[model samples]
Target: MSVAAAWARCDERVVARQTLITFVGLRDPYAHDPHEDGRHKGPILTLLDERSFDRVILLGRPHRADHSERTRQALKELHPKLSVQVIGLELADATHHPEILAKLRVVLARIRRDGPDDEWSVSLISGTPEMHACWVLLAVAGELGAKLLNFRRTVHNGIAGPRFVRELGWGEPLASLRPETLALLSTRRDRWDDVDQQGAAHTPPRHYFSRAILELAVNLSRHLAPLLVKGEPGTQKHLFASLVHQFSNRASGPLLIFNCATVPADLFETVLLGEEGDGGDGKLRQADGGTLVLIKAQELPAPLLARLLKAVDDGHYFRARGRTPVKVNVRLILTTERDFEEEVRLGHLPVEIWRRLRTALITLPPLRERPGDVLRLAKDELERLNRTLPRPKRFSPAALAKLESHRWPSNVSELRRVIEHAVLTAEEPAIQPEDLDFELAVNLANVFTAAVPRLREGFSMMDYLRAMKLELVRGALRKTGGNQSKAARLLGLTPQAVSQILRQTEARE
Candidate 1:
């Protein structure tokens, strides 16, 4: 019989007996919350309850069985007729074991033969890649005319969908899913798009130099395809890091970020590399198969840097004092304010490590060169801060003009702080010039002056404009210390525009 016809036959059998659902997981702490009430139960238990499945088989590593058993017991109590099975596999035996698949097939086959008198189905709940492999096995049984029920985690309402199944990719399987399944997936995707749109909409105003910094970020992200950015204080390196993460191939992966500066230097290595005991594998291991963003990497000790560099080069980490080295395929994106190239040149950084990262350099521009961005940033920040504060507020035209005219030595971060401060301190709906931190305003006014005329005769206005633009660009480039996106935002231009301008300038030169 055809796969669809077979699935239809199996569906009739499934509705007759108590349906069985299986959960596959690798000991995650987040999954350990007690499910005594079963109201706010774990994903597996929740899926079973929602589908009204008669049985649930919880499978996980032996180390995690203690926690899994608690959940299993909760499921039994919640649905008195529901049967619960708990299976534990050795950590080493998980990925390569054929028995796991065999046991899973046996469970599904049994459920197919003895249909529950009431409505029932079986589902496998798994978030880990290894556990996800079970889908292939289930799909095979499904092909053999055994009824298969699949449940995917939903970001909203946390409910499972009941749908008839066929071959995994024989046709467009996702398209054939129940309306509820499609709706949940659509909602999750829309939520992601909304975040991206919100971030893009908040793009700050650009000054002359901002474009250059953005260019640097775009170039580094494109050429290197993946990179680690390190720069000095007030350089907006983190902003560039965010841009890179947003634009890279692994953008879909969780953007796990940790600042080395905020974390004590003594614990920096442990935090970045991760620890062994207490289910903590450190940052490098946890971020395995995803992107591990280390902000303020300059603060890390030389030894920790060496370990990280080794992991980056080898694509796996040799945990300190741990057993076997865990193989982790991860993209390392480190950001720092320190001039690592200089450090490498001065022999502070090893030559091998420098060689691996030489091509991925991205410097961020400081705030001073991108004066135009100041007003825009102020506006955006004020708008955001207004949402939190008691009343709506706006920067007066004169205040905005004053902001644009003054140099921002502290860059975007400083600008954000100033706006937040002004919002907090302002008495009225309008932010007057006096409301702004006068000290910052005075400091900025003294820093920037009108462009001095070039002594070289026959300098065209176009040439002057070009020169001025380049100067601002270069300054912003230096200020971001060389993150391109922040520079672009600082310049009120797109990262792509900044890169094009730079390329054109380079060609002309």
Candidate 2:
């Protein structure tokens, strides 16, 4: 017996209660039996018309030597309100035997274009070879905005009976399947999983990065903009690198990134400049026509820094292993916590390298300078993390406020770690202040304590507020290239309000 038949027999109550039912069949001999008709269609149509079922699916037996077209014709005549899909056994040519997949796609597309309403019942007919066809069908259901119902089969006296009924959609069950299905489900799901499993945490997209960071990315794209983004550990420098890559002309090209601090000094030269060993080219050659993002570039030794600066200026490098000088078409993006100028003055970086970097210099303000961005980043992180985990978790208002009040020394990265940890450890659905780790809470408390004394001593809150407001406004303006409407959206204010603020700040100046 088919899954749909087994479901109808076991949970007749729930089956009779649905408004529409979709009967799914695998190719089998029993599916061709004329007496097997009422299992999916009759009950589903009864419920839908009676406000019990809106949709129903029936799985028909596979078309074999003994199977007749009478079953198909009978089903068509019986369930006119039901949409029938035949999952063909032919895998040799998808183009020729397009009936099953084609009809399925059409049904799904209709669901996508026009959502499920009171008008129709959905049903599917297939054979045994198409057992795995559930993946494609479920995906179609998801595309059409249909919630999936989990119906389990029960066997009584060696006869399969539809007994258990539970409903779950594409997320959980699909996640449990093989990786291939996960890849086809949603683009974001695959990306999130890959990044998470690979231990690669992404920076928030362009929509979430601060206006200052966005502006810096834009400016960097226009020229070899050397930006010193100084924020506590989690400030999202990697995300900023991705944003720059997105904006640059080489957006389609390879984005070669290396964490300078993590790599040893000996490997730095070979990694960045590339070596001939191990059937590979050096980093410079690999990143030749694209961007080379060096995270914590300040950590590199002076000698390596000089060599790097030479490559950036000359656009070419001679590998230590090989003598041939290779001309590289590369863009240099360096992230550092130390002041580059001070480092140069302290003879850490060559003066000539500083000259190459001076043309486009962007200084990223710490998270403390952009409190408004805190909530935005938190929301983005929550949405991203929810995909991988089994349960749903959201931040409470108090939790968000606490996050905003704290000085994010580690920046976005640190915040993500804390939130991920909290989500993993929490017993309830929502993340609260108590869910936060003690160490993080203590650090945040210290920040508040330090700021309180300054505030009490007449630390000019109005001036500080005005300055931050101006910086955000200016950063938005810079990001949008003076487009008032876009800048207004970025600042989360009305266009007129942004204009008014801009005029008021100008007058004050």
Once superposed on the true structure, which residue ranges of model 1 sit more than 4 Å away at CA?
1-226, 262-266, 275-279, 438-509
Q: Which candidate number maximizes lDDT?
A: 1
Instruction: Give the RMSD in angstroms, all C-alphas superposed, for model 2.
Output: 19.8
Q: Candidate 2: where is the Cα deviation over 4 Å?
A: 1-204, 224-230, 275-280, 438-509
- Please report the TM-score between candidate 1 and the true structure: 0.45
- Local accuracy of candidate 2 as per-residue lDDT tens digits, 113-222: 44333333332223222322443344544543344333223322223333233233344434344433322222221111122111123322554565445545656666
> What RMSD, rounded to one decimal, does every model reach?
19.2, 19.8
Superposition TM-score, candidate 2 onto the true structure: 0.48
The positional error of residue 256 in candidate 1, measured at the CA in angstroms, is 2.2
**What does candidate 1's lDDT look like per residue over 107-214, in tens digits?**
555654654353434343343333334443444335323344443221211222222222123124343443322222222221111222212222112222254454
Question: lDDT per prediction?
Answer: 0.55, 0.55
